[model samples]
Target: MGVSVFSLKGKLALITGGGTGIGLGIAKTMIEAGAKVVITGRRETVLQEAVDTLGKNAHYRVNDITEKETLPAMVEDIENSIGPIDILVNNAGTHHKATAQETSDKDFERILQTNVMSVFALTRECARYMLQRKKGSVIMIGSMAGLFGIDKIVAYGTSKTALTGLVNALVTEYSKSNVRVNAIAPGWITSNMFLNAIANDPQRKQQITNRIAMDHFGQTEDIGHAAVFLSSEAAKYITGVVLPVDGGATVNF
Candidate 1:
């Protein structure tokens, strides 16, 4: 109802896997909206570089979310040493490019551990703190792969599909309180990693673009912009919904 709806001033946002790609982009967008952002990853170097690029308000956490033994302690540490975690972006995930039949048990387990389990662990721990504050947001980065029967990425697709379920259940229980939860399903984004993959093969790129209604892939910033909105008051009424920022890919296809 006011200009402050989309403003994230004075908020603290933590983004996992935020040292690069879509995560980094979202961190930058939130900072621009006046939110203090912490971009985290397993690698110290990458996290540090991301912090540097994101300016002083940007911080880095080197803890691996998949390491269950450390997540609880790390969350507590950040809460006390850093600040109350007002927002959590469970963006850390792993992608496996393999056919359903060809994918190994280990591969499946690894994907689940990173993409799903880690999110569950971090959210559960962080929710305790948010419950006390009665104000926070949790954003799970999902994928368009879950929208349909995508090929050659069974593990990745399944995890994203599960994320929707997570959002729905969590929102139903938390909407009446301080914590709000939601998810974003992004389509083929033109990040450095993705652009290289698309550029390496001509037909694959064209086929993908042709299938999308916009005739193009989305930029990482597009997803970032979406994240900022969801974390801000602009999305106060929005929860438990999976917003697809897929460049009309879902509709056309």
Candidate 2:
């Protein structure tokens, strides 16, 4: 091909939890693909650091997705101040490892509020703007926990599973308006989150790798590339679908 179908020139994308890890990876890739990227997180310092490192095309905002009531105004501010968001990546999510019996109400609510409630709130507000403009892509950062139940992640897994429903519902509702909604279920991505835990135990690492056909830790860039492809014109006809960037972990095991 003369140029990749993944060109995102002139597009504006908003990524949540973009100060680090997979969120930052997505922001970086989108910027390289010629999109103006705005990233938001609870830490201003970290977000700024990401913006500084990501160069002039990247912008940063400080906002906590856990604050459900504040999401509307935050989304509004981005739309008005940063320009219309042609793409929204709901990448902000938190996970707590606990069995259903051991999970407390406070912990359960926290997970639901951060992972499910905020995503819906942000998606709703962004969908409104996209509906008016009649063009947009809302990409959800789903997890393998949702695709297949994982132990000790009762609350987190529940929220991620809910994300799939959100994608399907919105896809049906907004496809008529030319707004496409999709989700990506990433396998274990190599991040500070995973690296620190697996630093010493080669056996644990091997156990993890054996589950995946790829036989390696999937990097943040892998997720970034997947997000770009799904958000770009390359996947114009794709919607209501959950694409796995999991390296066959879900299937191989």
For all the candidates, what are their Cα RMSDs to the real structure? 1.4, 1.6
In model 2, pairs of residues that clash are none
Report the lDDT tens digits of candidate 1 across residue range 11-44: 8898999999999989989999989987788899
* lDDT (Cα) of model 1: 0.87
lDDT of 2 by residue, 164-190 (tens): 998888877999999999999989898
Local distance difference test scores for all models: 0.87, 0.89
For the record, the alpha-carbon RMSD of candidate 1 to the native fold, in angstroms, is: 1.4
> Model 1 Cα displacement at 207 (Å)?
2.3
**lDDT accuracy of residue 252 in candidate 1:** 87
Worst 10 residues of 1 by lDDT: 192-201
Q: What lDDT does candidate 2 reach at residue 133?
A: 91
Candidate 2's TM-score: 0.95
